[model samples]
Target: MPTTVLVAGFRGSMGQKATAMIKRDPELELAAVYSPHLETTDPAAYDLPATTQVFNQLSAMDTPAQVWVDFSTPAGAFENAQFALEHGMTPIIGTSGLSDDQVAQLTKLAKEQHQAGLLVPNFGLSAVLLMQFAKQAAQYFPDAEIIEMHHADKKDSPSGTAVNTAKMIAAGRKQAPETVENPVETIPGARGANYEDVPIHAVRLPGYVAHEQVLFGGPGEALTIRQDSFDRESFMHGLNIAIKQVNRLKGFAVGLENVL
Candidate 1:
């Protein structure tokens, strides 16, 4: 039987691509599409089948969608995933604005409800492998930094992949020695954002799709691990993997590698 799916943020670039991928897959059914920003709830307007349900308001959503594939904004993702969990739909979250606390709360709720889902940082297999490789590298080189580049229109700074990479590095590395910030620089924030002692630099440019590099330095030597997603299609393979394996999970979890 085909898996019924609902796509949030259907009007956005990534969301539109996900919708098309679903349509092309015979095993997946496009049961619905949603976007709070959309003016019309007409499925036809969204280039969906006439039978596909459309929802502009989360409060009004009533569909047969068994899987909630969210490519919504960071602002809307938390609530969207929460709704999916509450409604007994397995959520495959791709949007990345959720805080650690929010993820914890969702994790708790999922276990209580006995629902299964995932909060994926980056769906590109290369990105997932980069994060995994960075974690392994962190064991040997404790001093590390990350630089992430995305398109100019990307709203989130320090893309989820960068943040996840930092977290992975933090998890694998030994205790980092405390150090004071350099006061010599005239610029106040030139050092970039700090997460668990790992510095992350985010670059926004017109030509970049999504790219990240984790650099580690020690004993006058350095190692760099990088991944690039030149096109949105790069993420489809991992998302497809998540969608297929989510039903086997016990509760809400984080990371695409977990599903892989």
Candidate 2:
């Protein structure tokens, strides 16, 4: 039997793309869809098959689902994921902004239940490669900064990709080095926020979709890696890959690199 998948935010762009991809894939099946705002009578009004079950609450889902895909907001992700895991379902989290403490808790739950869970900060392949390159470059440069730009409507200031990239670079380094303490009066707050000594700058603009640049500076040379997502479709392929691989994973996994 094919793996049954339930999408939490089935009406959103990411969720819709994932649903379409899951329907096309041979290994996965769209078992159900859930959205808080969806009407109980016509939950499948948004292009889904009329036979598909529409649920407004997680408790309303009676049938067993193998996997639960979350493309919802940060505020809703943890609750949605918890509901799935408690019900013996695997969770594939595509939403960002989950804290370290929350991740640890979720990891513990996944381990206790012997179920798999995945939290992907960024689901773009190019973004994952860019982070990998940054990790390698951190050792040589030791002094680097990241700039992330996204749509103005994005709630989080520092994108999850930026935070994860900084953490990865920090972990790869030998030791924490002292940052240059030169105080410049040219402009206040010019340097941006520091994530474990790695400066991070966030930009929110109307036209931007999602973009990031990591710059590493050494004695005389500098290297920069950048990735851009022009549309939501850029995330579809990676998300599909994650959905297929989530069941095979034993515990919690962060980032797309683990599956890749």
Q: Please, what is the TM-score per model?
A: 0.97, 0.93
Best by lDDT: 1
Q: Evaluated with TM-score, which candidate comes out highest?
A: 1
> Where does model 2 exceed 4 Å of error?
182-188
lDDT of 1 by residue, 1-260 (tens): 99999999888888988888888899989999998877887777777999899998989989999999999988889999889999989999999878999899989989988999899989999998999999999998999989999999999898888999999999998768346675464786688998988989989999999999999988879999988899999888888888878988889889987777
131-194, model 2: which lDDT tens digit per residue? 9988887877778899999998888879989999999889777756556677674786688888
Worst lDDT run of 10 residues, candidate 1, spans: 177-186
Once model 1 is optimally superposed onto the true structure by TM-score, how far is the C-alpha of residue 146 displaced, in angstroms?
Answer: 0.3
What is the alpha-carbon lDDT for the whole of candidate 2? 0.86
Q: Candidate 1 at 227: error in angstroms? A: 0.7
